[model samples]
Target: MREEKLSVDIENIVKKWEGKKGSLIMILHDIQNLYGYVPRATSLQLSNYLEVPLARIYEVITFYHFFKLEPPGKHLIQVCMGTACYLKGASDLLHELRDILGVREGTTTKDGLFRLEVVRCLGCCGLAPVVKVDSKVYSKVTKDRVADILSEYEQEAAVK
Candidate 1:
């Protein structure tokens, strides 16, 4: 079953958009912010509330990276593989993360603790070799540091 909190959140968004024409996009954005990904329930609910077709809702959800159909991991690891980062062994870092998480790029680990992604750039060229773990940024990454960096998250997960 889906969490009640998510249902409550969707209800709130629907209420906020009541009688407000052209609020579909805003409501969807708020919904995505509340939940890391846009669950199927939310999409259907939004469609019903906005009088929008499910196809349109699905289109928007798939078009944007911010809206995910599936649940995301606790930690979203984005490795910047831009020209600068690539020159600085960003690919190696990506491989190390995949090895540690046992998931390939653009996929979440089975444990759901981590998702590995390769992005074009994180706009931290000066700090080439950048990676974003959830909202935190790590620069100057090294192959040796991968285990250490991931170990910290593993320890946190253990405590949880």
Candidate 2:
């Protein structure tokens, strides 16, 4: 329902993928990479640019677990829940994060500082119970270390 003009970057994205097989997903991935999510305004432009139905655009976005509809927080926190991580107390780390952030998994905090998510695996089973913030991986995490991990981001935000 919003009127939007495509950004130069997105225009190029559409032009690059137009009429190509499997273009929709590729276009969507680029959009997500650009904005951290598949935004409504951008979707409108993409729909018009590709002569693709808005519903079809939404179907692909909603079907992919990786696609996000809203803006993500400044920081992304992922707790690994692979079999090894789970066995090594990944649940504890997740619960601690949820308590400290005051938001459940898959939701952003009110301040927009952090977005917490439970992931199936990080593939470092040898380093089970891992927590990743942004790109830094904290291996062998415990419930007690959650605050210190969060504090690093909070402090970084304060400095900037």
Candidate 3:
């Protein structure tokens, strides 16, 4: 909910790459890991500090899906739509989530607590229907379990 709070410590992020241009990508990777997304302000600051061109910074950030330009929701829900997952009722699960959250895929709720997305695969073929909430993975997902999963998020939001 606090977009301003989601920022990378510019000094620290750049200091890690001292003396090496090759460390650029690795440094940005760490920055993304810390901020969830790369804010333009942070990118500009990085460019100024690292002596790297702003265009190059923007290029790398845009090329990587992990480096979002905007701050993400408090919780990111990724539903697997891989062949195995789809055949195992992943679409149905997606619908249930949309209905429950009152939002379509690739959107965040008004409260910013949840964001929904359909991914190609989560590399969990064995767990055909897989859903990942933030960093946690839920396997063997079913319609009946959707409410339980969402309720858990609701509770977490309420607590926050």
Candidate 4:
């Protein structure tokens, strides 16, 4: 029953792009946008519906950094690794986060509350060693503040 709904949803998405040039990427983008990440099942349905091979779907998904194969955590921790940030000890920040959260980059925590990731820049060099939790940016972050920052989120989660 659920599979049928997914098939219809994917079909509607594909119908909008059918017979169009350069539609695969656009279609994948829409799928990712809808699902937060592209489920393997939906990708297979897309392959059959579009007459495109499964390998081709994966090729594009893997090629694009924006596309995610897994659902993101409730709080996405993006640590800036730009030149200024790195020089300001972003690597140490990253390490501390991994140690504290018990999760590496591109992975969510066991509780699904946090996901760690590294980005080249957040465009806030003056605020080097920055970390962004969802839409909120924490600037000039240090290892000492890691626990406090995490605790704030934990508190919020507890309240919710």
Best by lDDT: 4
Model 3 spans > 4 angstroms off: 1-8, 99-107, 123-127, 135-140, 143-145
Stretches of candidate 4 exceeding 4 Å from the true structure? 1-6
Write the residue-wise lDDT of candidate 4 on 20-48 in tens digits: 98899999989988888898988887777
Give me the overall lDDT of model 4.
0.89
Q: Please list the residue runs of candidate 1 whose C-alpha ends up more than 4 Å from where it truly belongs after superposition.
A: 1-6
lDDT of 1 by residue, 59-111 (tens): 77778776766667888889999999999999999888888788888778888
Q: What value of lDDT does candidate 3 attain over all alpha carbons?
A: 0.83
TM, every model: 0.81, 0.86, 0.73, 0.89
lDDT winner, 2 or 3: 2
TM-score of model 1 vs. true structure: 0.81
The top-ranked prediction according to TM-score is: 4
lDDT tens digits by residue: candidate 2, 1-160: 2246678989888878776887899999988998898889888887876777899999999988999987899999999999999999999888888888899988889898999998888989998889999899999988898999899999999999
Return whichever of 1 and 3 wins on lDDT. Answer: 3
Q: How far is candidate 2 from the true structure (C-alpha RMSD, Å)?
A: 2.6
Better of 1 and 4 by TM-score: 4
> Rank by lDDT, descending?
4, 2, 3, 1
Each candidate: RMSD = 4.0, 2.6, 5.3, 2.8
